[model samples]
Target: MPPADGPSAPPGGDEVDRIVAAWRRVAPDLDVEPLEVLSRVARLAHHLDRLRRGAFAAHELETWEFDVLAALRRAGGTHELSPGQLVVQTLVTSGTMTNRVDRLERRGLVQRRPAPDDGRSVLVRLTPAGATVVDAALADLVRAEHRMLAVLPAGERRALAALLRRVTAPFETTARG
Candidate 1:
């Protein structure tokens, strides 16, 4: 049921709408238009992170752990990649990647072995346990995501995804530290 407040916002308006409304009332000249889109994106990202945390935790994994595992799982049949490669795919510093790998190693979710071509470098391989956990977590994540987007039709979801990709393309292409 909707809130029985003093005055209801127009159809489909939400909390962000209320905020924008207030900002509009306060600063009639300033261009707060961007907030209408970016603010909701920020709020949605928060919800997504929370949902992912719950989904991954149920599979005994952390968000970072799932990221590494998912990277490996997408690395074709071998399901392995060099630490440098993992760093690139995960957008983490090499040092951070090493620490992440160390923690994951302790949890028995990944294993390190000498690279076939490079004697000095080692490749990180996802253990069977890792694959199972990541796969299950992914399934759970997808189901939650599906429910979240259920309000939108299938075509809208695809279009939204494409639009999001366009919005994210610049960030994805930019160098990260």
Candidate 2:
């Protein structure tokens, strides 16, 4: 098939295009329009995950390590957050976060200290080394993503981001736990 988007679609078509074409042939009654957009998003997500892994690995960091370190780095000012806050931001259970913090602490990437104002509460702080690694990983991740999005003009990228936000907002609001 020539694909749905006419001249704008890639001349040779992609895997999603082929899948849509095959599905159409078997079930012509169904509307496969959604696949053209969502399937591409799914594939892009897979590729992005790989890029993230590579970027983190280059910094000698694991994905979860990056997540926690990045969260702490983003905490500004003191570069620290209570363990509970870290759990929420990293979206992990307290036990998992505790183990991660322990591992990271052993590597000198983070430290736990009593909250200054609330001695009973403990806070996880990203060490300078952790900040450096997370920052480098973030830069690499952004550069890779920019390369992938280079095919689109700025305006189109903005428009696509807006469209994706609309698609994602509901799920984010509901599925965030």
Candidate 3:
């Protein structure tokens, strides 16, 4: 649950009264019902941001670091992936991905190697240390997500995920197309 003063709730009776008055006079014909759902999305995103910060902080990892590490982790054992592949999976600019890889390499988390099939390209693989860090961080992250989901009943959580997938399906299909 969010704090009482969190944006998920209306500001106050007075503020709501003023908004109702303004809407009644200024846009009487416009349906404001969508605002309720959109506002909750905005508020929930804000809350989730805080949760993510705290969760990542526990493993001494920033959100961006986790983004990269998690991508490699998902690639399977040895956590090997090309820089280009990481950029695609991470949805980051090539330069940004290069910088991230450099930082991770410097921290002894990952290494770059000549690509087996391509002389002009390199593959980034997680070192043993990197694998350990990613494993620990992933465990912590899963625990945090589990805690968050605990607020909802199991059935409701599944329903919410299904609904969100339905909402997002068109965008995913368009992007793929």
Candidate 4:
């Protein structure tokens, strides 16, 4: 079977031509739209993955490492959080979180410490070295993101973000619940 979202041939020319013809017949007053904007967004995200891989590679960090490290960095001063907390922030399974923490600890980037009030639990705290790497990586990542957003004016970028948030808000709430 053809993919559900794949373009159908136009009736007289190709899929879209057919779609327009049918629309014209069924609803003469309605507009038949171009799919360019949404299509481009999807295509651009694919290309952006390549650019991101290069950016992460330059820092000698894997994408997974950046995900985990950035979550810790965003946890405010001292950059300490429990493995369970990291799992929530990063949206990874508990086993994956444990593995990431283990690898980072081995590299001396973070360490596991007893939770202050919970004897059976441990917190993952960024080491001085981890903090140094995260800070540098974040600076570089910001520059990369800025480069990607340069095509849009500041106001346009803000508007786009607002629109995207509106589109995604329902899904976000559903996921959280």
Candidate 5:
């Protein structure tokens, strides 16, 4: 099926088109518009997830490791955040975050230190090794995503990004509230 915007045909549109066609045949009156866009998004997400996993694995890191390392790396100079802050940034439960920190510490990818402002709380800092691995994994993931988007021209890619932002912004805005 042709994309709502862009070229006359999708780069590899067999499955969505076939599925949509079957739905139309079985239920001609039903509006399957949502299926077209959402099904493709789900499939693309699955593909992207696999690509990211492979990219991280190539650097000897898991998705959780990359997530925690990235949060600390983005914290800048000190390259550290309290466990509470990491939990917020990584969107994991505090218990899960602690487990992740423990594993990363064991791997020598991160270190823990007492928070200067609050003696009872600790900070998780990215070690040199963690920064190196996360950075490489992020670079690989970007390259892989770019390759996956090769079918779209620059203008169409921008348009699609804008469209997706419109679709996602509501959920994000609601979450912040």
Candidate 6:
């Protein structure tokens, strides 16, 4: 019988289960706990990426474009960030950020203006059109995510997030270091 709170494992079923069993049979000495969790995480990320791409596309925005626009949108009321700052937020290379800014500028979604305080520096500002589209895309994305997470109860969801954060913290810390 399945547990009332979570998914049930049917006899000799579930893809993850099958994979784990196969690995155990092939390499019984190896610890596969990380694979069991991380594999699912990777798969989930792939699906989420597709879902997010679809949601953003509905607003006539590609994922990369949305990432830049949303980063600017979240940068307080000014809705602008230096390309260097954007590179940090979006985790793209300097050249990539420059290209993104250029594309967005051409699309009338963003503009490059001389920084007020730093005469030599330029800031990428989200235009009204960019803000409108990004905002709509964000709303749609959130709705879709909420629907996907609806499978878990509030308490379980919180616990899952905490657990995942704990598992992921080391990687984030290492990257920062």
Candidate 2, which ten residues in sequence have the lowest lDDT sum?
Answer: 1-10
| Candidate 1 positional error at 176, Å | 8.0
lDDT of each: 0.91, 0.89, 0.80, 0.80, 0.89, 0.89
- Candidate 1 residue 107 Cα shift, in angstroms, is 1.2
lDDT of 3 by residue, 1-177 (tens): 434333233455443444444565568898876555555666677878888878788888888888898888889976899998898788889999999999999999889999989999999998888778778878887888889889899999999999889978998887545
Residue lDDT tens for model 6, 39-127:
88888999899999999989888999999999999997889999998998888899999998999999999999999999999999999
Candidate 4: segments with Cα more than 4 A from true spot: 1-38
Best by TM-score: 1
Candidate 6 residue pairs in backbone clash: none
Each prediction's RMSD to truth: 3.3, 3.9, 5.3, 6.5, 5.1, 5.1
Per-residue error (Å), model 5, residue 63: 1.2
Runs of candidate 3 with Cα error greater than 4 angstroms are 1-26, 175-177
Q: CA lDDT of 93 in candidate 5? A: 94
Candidate 6: minimum summed lDDT over ten consecutive residues — where?
A: 1-10
Quality of model 2 by C-alpha lDDT: 0.89
Which 10-residue span in candidate 1 carries the lowest summed lDDT? 1-10
Query: Candidate 1 local accuracy as lDDT?
Result: 0.91
- TM per candidate: 0.91, 0.87, 0.82, 0.77, 0.88, 0.90
Candidate 5, after superposition: displacement of residue 156 in Å?
A: 1.6
Q: Write the per-residue lDDT of candidate 2 for residues 1-177, one digit (tens) a residue.
A: 455543223467788887787777778899999999999999999998898899889999899999999999989998999989888887889999999999999999999999889989899999988888899999998898899899999999999999999999997887574
lDDT of 1 by residue, 51-109 (tens): 99999999988899999999999997889999989999988999999999999999999
Q: Whole-model lDDT for model 5 versus the true structure?
A: 0.89
Error of 5 at 133 (Å): 0.9
